[model samples]
Target chain A: MECTDFKLIVVGGSAGSFSVVSHLLAGLRPDFKLPIVLSLHRLKHVRSGLVEGLSLKSKLRVIEPNDKEKLQQNTVYLAPANYHLFVELDGTVALSTEESHNHSRPSIDHTLGSAAYAYRDKLLGILLTGANRDGAAGMKEIADNKGFTIVQDPLSCDIDTMPKEALKLFRPDRLMNPEDILHFLNALPG
Target chain B: MQNSEKDYNYKEYLLILKECSPYDFSEYSDNSIDRRIKKIMRDQGLNMEELVLKTRTEPDFVEQVVEAITVNTTELFRDPDVWNHILKKVLPALKHQKKINIWHAGCSTGQEVYSLLILLDHLQILDRAEIYATDISKKALEQAKKGQYFYNFNAEKYRENFKASFEGETVPDFDSYFSADADKDLLKIRTDFSEKVQFIKHDLVKGDLPFYNKFDLIFCRNVLIYFQGSLQSKIVERFHENLFPGGTMILGSHESLGGFFKTKFSKNGPVYHRTNSFHFKY
Candidate 1:
């Protein structure tokens, strides 16, 4: 199946990912049908700025979904701060105040791993720039689930710890920079 | 992945839970349930079969498993902004009431209970307030009754949150409601505050309301996030039914009411007000 045929797109990132994520969202056409779920590491005490910042750069609506909110196409759902966002089989988001993994609430590994399980081969996972290894195991989980996996190129990142750690696991399908990622997603089969 | 439960499926485990205990967690969100089960197996050094065997044979052990399944971590002023909103906005409306009944459903470990107690005290209505706190886990209920915490775990964060909630208001001295034992690293709730709260073991998913008071305010925060969507709706409906007309119920910040509840409660963030005439759902 073509990449765009996937039911969900989950992007996990931490440090140095803001610019890359912004670039990717900025370049996507307004008609992009794939719902992108973001599990970004954010300051737990600070909650308001991320979606507002990202929304300014993208045509698609960026949201911090309420617990039990249904997934919608043409929308970008950012994980709410201090909660883990799990994509349920019924296609609604379940937020939990459960223990943090890797010292991070809204753990990328959790969001990506759960999406891999829920969407299986219909999931496209993007592990982007960060200073930690949180998304690496999740990226591996995506690969193991036969889902499409993309890691942001280390050379193109502000901090390479995330993708570099991911590379140590199974090789992802693509190691693309911001521009390549944008273009590839734009050209995905409708 | 160590000593993994190869076939201890959630459905089977839930069935075991239902048979062995009064608790029914089949309506919990699947991923949270799955992870908690794995954690239980890994921590206790029990395989799937051993875990199931223990649960089926030992009533006490099943209760322990239920304790392990329930997530119980909460802090003083965990979400200070919400508390601030409650203090500044929600609690004021109830200040003049002759009597106030408040229930904390799934009041894990009691930080949230004391947080509200302080608010009631600040409003000078602590004497008139009837505070009932209940949780499914006996261990948590015991801790809630004690109303004590490790100072190391609570001091700094508690101070910070307390400050945030009373930002413009006169901040009380730290020694007023709690005392810190430096050598023991313990934060003991002053008896005056602890004695007022009546802690009970109530399961929001299974058991009847701990007491039927037609509560004026309810706080079931962070508890329902573990629940499945339909369960979330059902529990919200239950809270709605128990809420007095024009009463307020606060849920977790991340949680909101769905289903016909979207129309039943007037929402201001997680602060939901019971509105309109009551009707039985078909």
Candidate 2:
């Protein structure tokens, strides 16, 4: 449940959170080495634009990784549209089109829960401003696995349903504003 | 080795299944296969021990287990933009060849093959094309050969995908390509389209090339996502060996050749144009 011990960082969001995510990414240290995986609900029909949008502010290279691609350091990997991103027990990620869970491909729960399963206590799971309950069980899974879980402070969210849902399921390790989250990540030890 | 306890169990489960059946998923990406295994356990209401017992005792059940393990959740023209690119760009580029050869590795339920057929037919070049498809799952190969799918599962989506692929252009009579029975809730790819395709039970992970001749293009979309990174490279390398010098390899939209393979196959827009210009380190 500590910042420096994490091997991977997973962030999940749905509605009204892109700007917040951009802001957080804008503030992250350029030297950040932990592999960050972002799973956001997107227009599945549209093939492009999410990476372009996120790349505008990310300090590290933002890529929609190919399947079976290794989790690389100093990079931000965004889940591609129409695919579920599962973190493997090995140091790679696999993509699947298995009937979308919770009505969304690249399901946040799948990404977060799989990361929790793969990295256990070496993972940090974050739930951001969103209108859906897709990432609630995933945050609890992170907590159960002794990994750190951070839910954005509900009062500071554009839509609080996602964080509120997570809070209802289990107490996470931290409740912070986007700025605080950025600060905590930036201040992490080697 | 952090979760060695669970890892040990999965290794045992895989070994037991391999011992009893022809299927071997040991090289598959662990999370992808393990997650499917967990679902199989739930759906069949068998714990790991009982599952292994069933696999041992029931020869017939092994086939079902293999089907479940391999993910075959494809839809007709799942991504229209990619199909649009194929129809407009990739297919027409192969005009020099008198007869084009195509191989669809892991052709699940055959929707993609049918989609390509419809395109090639529109281009009026299907008569001179040799189409072959292969899948590890015999059941999936049978369904692909049958050329039928539940209406809700693929029929309705077929029309939608057709329209999207030809967004600006006036799409042809898409209905003419297929026959549908709403009462039976089944849709069949017309005999004309289905007959041109030859389905073979070729396992990409194990089986050798089903055809001796090299292909002009290989469509292996979304199939490599199931294997480990090492296997992904190996599979792509195998495709390189099976392709004609100037042939193109069309992978899933999100996939690409990594490491040394990147140098081997050069990406040109939507497809990887196989490059034979250099003979570098092996």
iRMSD per prediction, in order: 1.1, 1.3
Query: Model 1, which residues run further than 4 Å from truth?
Result: A1-4, A44-47, B1-8, B181-183, B278-282
lDDT of 1 at B166: 81
Please name the candidate that would achieve the greatest TM-score relative to the true structure. Answer: 1
Error of 1 at A62 (Å): 1.1
Q: For candidate 2, lDDT tens digit of each residue in B1-282?
A: 556777788878998988888778888877778788889999999898999999999998998888888888787887888888888888888766698999999998899999899888888888889999999888888899888989875665678888888766669887788788888988888987787899998878874886865989899999888887778877888888889987988889877677788878888877887889566755
Can you give the lDDT of residue B35 in candidate 2?
82
RMSD of each: 2.7, 2.8
Please tell me the interface RMSD, in Å, for model 1: 1.1
Report every candidate's CA lDDT: 0.87, 0.86
B1-282: candidate 1 lDDT, tens digit per residue: 421343346668888889778889898877788889899999999987898899889988887788889998788887788999898889899888999999999999999999999988888889999999998989998998998899986687789889998877888776798988978999988898888999988888863764776899999989988887789888888888788998999988878776678778898755889888557553
The pairs that clash in candidate 1 are none
DockQ of all candidates, in order? 0.65, 0.65
